[model samples]
Target: METIVPNWPAPARVRALSTTRDGGLSQGAFAGLNLGAHVGDEAALVEANRGLLQQAAGIPGRLNWLNQVHGIAVHPVSNEYDGAPEADAACAHEAGLACIVMTADCLPVLLCDRAGTLVAAAHAGWRGLQNGVLEASIKAMGCKPAEILAWLGPAIGPSAFEVGGEVRDAFLAEQAEAVAAFIPSANEGKWLADIYQLARLRLARAGVSAVYGGEHCTFSDRERFYSYRRDGQTGRMASLIWLAE
Candidate 1:
């Protein structure tokens, strides 16, 4: 299966990869490498796709999946963990344990320290982003925000992510800097919100300056990515990070 390795300067020992919506057995709306199991894709098909991805990435252990409540909850991965936990972000201090986040259009952020000692994955879907998901992740990593490196995975680009007044207000009310990421759209009372820029802005506010890989447009890239906004019943992609043994 095709994958997008994060383009940040993270240490070589910290391996991270984001899977695209290509090369899988899923058919119809969930076509091509759909990794998310909760999106109505067949459980067997998603398991098979996960197998393919793990083998492709040479992941040594099970990937930690989150229920993704779109909140600021961050969990630490442990061997006792069974299935998906109710959290929006996960961090791994142990090597070979993959911290994963599944998304269609919502932002999947991967973060790691320069020393490759800690890694985290966050699912930021505007609400979570505004509610301090990234900041929570950085804090959970137990490292200074400035010492962490962040990479933005595929998401609905600004041109495609139209939002109502409530969405804009949710962010602007907390962060005045977020106003720069919104622009007036053709529809009255709606604005085109740049999820990437907004995420970068939040990271910046948290003192994370080493951000990269925000150019992907899930809405526009039909072949390589899945867009929930473009297809209401589409599948989801996975962005994962882990430290090497």
Candidate 2:
């Protein structure tokens, strides 16, 4: 039932939380609080865990879970949903409607405007960040970027996430200053990429200056969070937000 609430100064009605892998019924590798239905955990276990999540968060409304593909697509949600939609991000304008995304090592970003009329959750993996997932989510919210606030949830840290030269090159191609986010690892052409820094840079470029919570390291903290790189067959955590009615 443990959850991490955003520390940013979002409006009072802007409710948001990021779940940890600490309080659910899945066993074995997908041990506790595993909310990802597509990650090979027994369907029933994940469903039950999700129910626990609803009660713990006091959502008071239906959850609109998504089929995150690590792409830039942003789906809009209301109180009703036909099924989990295929999108890396979800935006909500309706009160009591939540926008959520699942993640392990990849970054989970929760966003809302100062007025709190809109909210969004995005799954920002390396590819998706490079391609523009956060920007797309921000654009979908239809708010002035300056009025938007972002909270960075758990993710693989720079010290633990090493990447080949191409990955560094990919980000550099978009913004040369992105080179600052990469430091040459011990491996000849490999680099330790700082996902938090990269995300901050992107948010700043997108005109979002008020950002918070890039402090959690999922790979290192096996107890509180899940990590795909730390464990291949691991559970996933949920980062969700909604407008309180």
lDDT string, candidate 2, 38-73, tens digits: 889999999999999998878887789998888999
Alpha-carbon error at 196 in model 2, in Å? Answer: 0.7
- Candidate 1, residue 4: the lDDT equals 92
After superposition on all CA atoms, what RMSD does each candidate show versus the true structure? 0.9, 0.8
Model 1: clashing residue pairs? Answer: none
Clashes of each: 0, 1
* lDDT for each residue of candidate 1 in 69-135, tens digit (9 for 90 to 100): 8899998998778988899999999989889999999999999998889999999999999999999
TM-score of each: 0.98, 0.98
lDDT on C-alpha atoms for all candidate structures: 0.92, 0.93
Off by over 4 Å in 1: none
